[model samples]
Target: AQSVTQPDIHITVSEGASLELRCNYSYGATPYLFWYVQSPGQGLQLLLKYFSGDTLVQGIKGFEAEFKRSQSSFNLRKPSVHWSDAAEYFCALRRDYKLSFGAGTTVTVRA
Candidate 1:
């Protein structure tokens, strides 16, 4: 069994501020990790993913994530967030064929 947890339910940040979203997972072995974003009414879009190789991976839209095995964390970061970046972010874990997701973190941006 595997599970993902996003401790932050909601986060508010000013435009141009650096943002970080936390994620933690539990699994018996190394699992595939991913970060996805969803707008108000749109479907989820893949932000980034870590399949293998480097622990630090770059993603679309100035986003990046690091896979920390010791901490069991895969946190997402953006140097400077825009108002458009405001959306619900989810952390997903996949093992074999089953995929599990975190509760999701709602990001709010203020001008």
Candidate 2:
């Protein structure tokens, strides 16, 4: 079985500050990893994905993620967060033709 774990349930980042979200996964082989962001009353939007090649992948909205196979982790990071970045972030793992998601981490941007 494959599962994803997001250690942080909620994060509060000051506007223009850097932010990082941790994610860990359990799977037998290298699995597809993705980061998605969802705004209030909106569906999940794909931030970035790691299929095979690169360990570090960039996404929209100034977000990026790195896949570290040795650590079984794929963490999302933003150099400078914006007020609009406040939203729920999800780390997903795709395996066996199914996607397994974490509980999610809600980011709250503070002034």
Candidate 3:
């Protein structure tokens, strides 16, 4: 079984500042990892994904994540955050055609 853990339940970031969200996964083998963001009253949007090859993967909205096998982590980061970036972020692990998600981290952007 695979599970994901998002250490931060809530995060507050200043507008135009950098932001990082921690995500750790527990699985036997390397599993497909994904980061999804959901704005208020909106559906989940794919931020980035890491399956194989590159250790660092970039996605839409200037977001990127690095897959570290040693740390069992796939943390997401954005160089500069915008007010619209405020949303709930989820870390998911896919295996056997099933997806397991983390508890989620809610990001609040302030000016």
Candidate 4:
């Protein structure tokens, strides 16, 4: 069974500040990893994925993530986040539509 868990239900970041979103998974084998961002009540946008190879993967909207085998975690990071980046960020596993999602972390960007 493959699954993802986001501990933080919501996060608040000042404009131009750094942001980190945590994600942990349970899988038999290394499964396709993904970070997606969706505006309120909108579709998801692919941030990045680590199917294999480099554990450190880069993604869209200046987002990146690292795959840690030991902890079974893949965390998302951004150097400086803008208010426009404010959205509902979801961490999803790539094992068919049966994707297990976190309760979604709503990012509040303070201007």
TM-scores, all models, native as reference? 0.97, 0.97, 0.97, 0.92
State the C-alpha lDDT per candidate: 0.96, 0.95, 0.95, 0.87
Task: Summing lDDT over every window of 10 consecutive residues in candidate 4, give the lowest-scoring window.
Answer: 94-103
CA deviation > 4 Å runs, candidate 2: none
- Of 3 and 4, which scores higher on TM-score? 3
Q: Report the C-alpha displacement of residue 94, candidate 3, in angstroms.
A: 0.3
| Model 4 Cα shift for residue 4 (angstroms) | 1.1
Model 1 TM: 0.97
Residue lDDT tens for model 3, 1-111: 438999999999999999999999999897799999999999999998998999999999999999999999999999999999999999999978888999999999999
**Pairs of residues at least 3 apart in sequence or in different chains that clash in candidate 2:** none
Q: Kindly give the stretch of ten consecutive residues in candidate 1 with the minimal lDDT sum.
A: 1-10
Off by over 4 Å in 1: none
Number of the candidate with higher TM-score, 2 or 4: 2
Model 4 C-alpha lDDT per residue in residues 20-83, reported as the tens digit of each score: 9999988877778888899877888888988999999999889999999999899999999998
lDDT of 1 by residue, 19-94 (tens): 9999999987987999999999999999999998999999999999999999999999999999999999999999
Model 3 stretches with alpha carbons more than 4 Å out:
none
